[model samples]
Target: MSALTETDPTGAGFSPEGLARIAPWMDRLVDEGRLAGLSVTVARRGRVAFARACGQADLARATPFTLDTVTRIYSMTKPLTSVAVMQLYEQGLFQLDDPVSRVLPEFAEMRVAVGGNRAKLETEPARRAITVRDLLTHTAGLTYGFMEATLVDAQYREHGVDYLAREGTLAEMTARVAKLPLLAQPGSAWNYSVATDVLGQFVAALSGRPFADYLREAVIGPLGMIDTDFFVRPELMPRFCATYAYDRARQLRLFDDSVETAFAKPPAIASGGGGLVSTAADYQRFCRMILNRGTLDGTRLLGRKTVELMLSNHLPGDLAAMGTPRFAETSYTGIGFGLGFSVMLDPARAQILGTPGEVAWGGLASTAFWIDPAEDLSVVLMTQLVPSSALPIRRELRVLTYAALAD
Candidate 1:
């Protein structure tokens, strides 16, 4: 395990004193029992300036967390899945505006719920076929079963839309989803749903290989993200971190043990939406690729213009207004959804300390990463906590990180 230490040289554009505040803040969180274990890393101009680890990876076993601790990065997998799809796009296999039905015909006859209760549902024809861009921007009408506030969301749970059956596959799961009514019309509004999972199926169909295989061969292999994958290998199990949730008394308690984790083996469906385990160092390589304009150590996964299009705002006027639901972890006032990330449009409107054009995303377990091209900066925060909305740690980390910039 790598100890918390400053790795920057004299000219790295980060104040050592300012960078020093980061570990202490994390220590405070662990001291307060808000987090079981955590690790953080910051880099600028392609060089690491700060790296640290704190708390116990397994409080019950007294295992110390380290920089190489593997964690379930959940939705952070979306960005990587998006990159894979775009790689096929670069091959001229399909256009962004192309209808998803063109590739996955199962979605051809999809319907929208007009106005109905969970007991009785009404339906209407979709305005148009859902496009690849709609899935990328989350304008598609798909809904996650876990988001159970709405009637459609409730229907998803009732129908077992998210069940990762031992014998089921992405193609079969998508086919099941097609039989359900959509939560909204295509391109009508922004809803965080199973759109990315659907994109995974589309990728498999277009690339002539399984989604995970293509992801490993095309993205993870080239980036040298040795520890990032859909499942943790047996040899690396000792370094995997356990997950936690706050008890009724708001105390940290064991939720999932690393030894018996679901990620111990691969699932039937490769959930490109929220199914990945990664390390701080491994994810940093992915972020650095984005920060370096689609290239890392001479390995180019995407073209410069393609990356620019991805980082730019894709939402229309006030479409981001639809993103501020009760469960949203981000401030929607000045943020917009891009191809595969959240783009900061105006930091002032967001009421947070950040630069415009910055792109970022977080996992369900409090893990997060951001790339600021303007500042040539990248930061990765790793931890294991269920119901990520439990704290504003991501915002807190942002303030601490930007405050330490020497330039």
Candidate 2:
């Protein structure tokens, strides 16, 4: 089948034949019924090198997937929240090292879970308060309820500490999280958690407005990410894609139908952790700002120095040194956590075809995007599938895309 792709890839150091290599691979997945549909965009030096969408967006409806189709971005929301909060930082609102409790009093005195399970929890006072830096780098002692790995997280599940839940505001949920015991002492380990949700509240507390409002005005609006938001509008429902998950037999099954999805309406909580829906085109604009070093067409969102700090590795070493290496957005070996994105310390160690200093992150629904400063590149993959680990698409695309680079 033919694909809707770029007419020319030469302007951005991409081999036209090399880009041709991507279509058949992408088509094979859809042909094999591995993915319902997917949209990919590869840009270099502020120009589109390659773009394509293959297969059905709504398999049941036989809807054709297009580049503008919107899908849930999930955890990918972290980077935007990080950038928004950092804008406040550039304005001298708060320092990276400042205690988050300085603005939100809920996190003033926190506890760490030292022993026991959800049934019989044990704890000790946090060695220190969770800091803005900790939240940004995920060094904060916070834990996600769904981890199912530790007593702290178990308690999180027991307490119904869910960010996706349609009830309660960000402020109410932040208070709920603060009341729970931390998985580790602040800055002790790297466990992916609801720290970004807390950062959302931190944004509201500092800005004296709602999290959604601040994000829209400061980050999403300024970057011209018009289709990126907490929920899809009624008029845009036709462009929303359905989400999927594998059944016990490893067959594709509808996870969330496109027509009747929570994303169709504005959410109550406005999760900063995993709650935005965006199109491949919209998200690329956001990536373009990062590649442009915190400015897009004279709409400067952050200072150049602040952008530098966001991309730098905040952890002392690689994520593997962070301990035990729990399930995270990226691999542990040579990957490092920057302010928001995962920094590639050494592509060889991570065993991926990526450049050193490249920053990237993915959503829970198998959607991913990476910005490479060294190569002046950004790639976005849009798809709807739960448990992003269900398939090796992210790494596979990494190999395929990097192999297509002419320079």
Q: What would the per-residue lDDT of candidate 1 be over residues 97-137, giving only the tens digit for each residue?
A: 99999999989988999997778999999989999999998
Model 2 earns a TM-score of 0.97
Once fitted onto the true fold, the runs of candidate 1 whose alpha carbons sit more than 4 angstroms away are 1-5, 163-167
Q: List the residue pairs that clash in candidate 1.
A: none
Give the per-residue lDDT digits (tens) of candidate 2, residues 1-407: 01224646888888888888888988998998889999889888777888889988899999888998989999999999999899899889888898889998888999888887556788899989889999998889888888787777777887788989898778888899999988888998888989999999999989998999999999998877878899998888888999999999888999999998888788889899999998898888888888888888888998888888899999999989986766646899999989999999999999999999999999999999999999999999999888888888889889988988887
- lDDT measured at residue 132 in model 1 versus the true structure, 0 to 100: 98
**RMSD of model 2, in Å?**
2.2
Most lDDT-accurate candidate: 2
| Model 2 Cα shift for residue 109 (angstroms) | 1.2
Misplaced by over 4 Å in model 2 are: 1-7
- The stretch of ten residues in a row with the least summed lDDT in candidate 2 is 1-10
Most TM-score-accurate candidate: 2
Worst 10-residue lDDT window for candidate 1 reads: 1-10
Per-model C-alpha lDDT, please?
0.88, 0.88
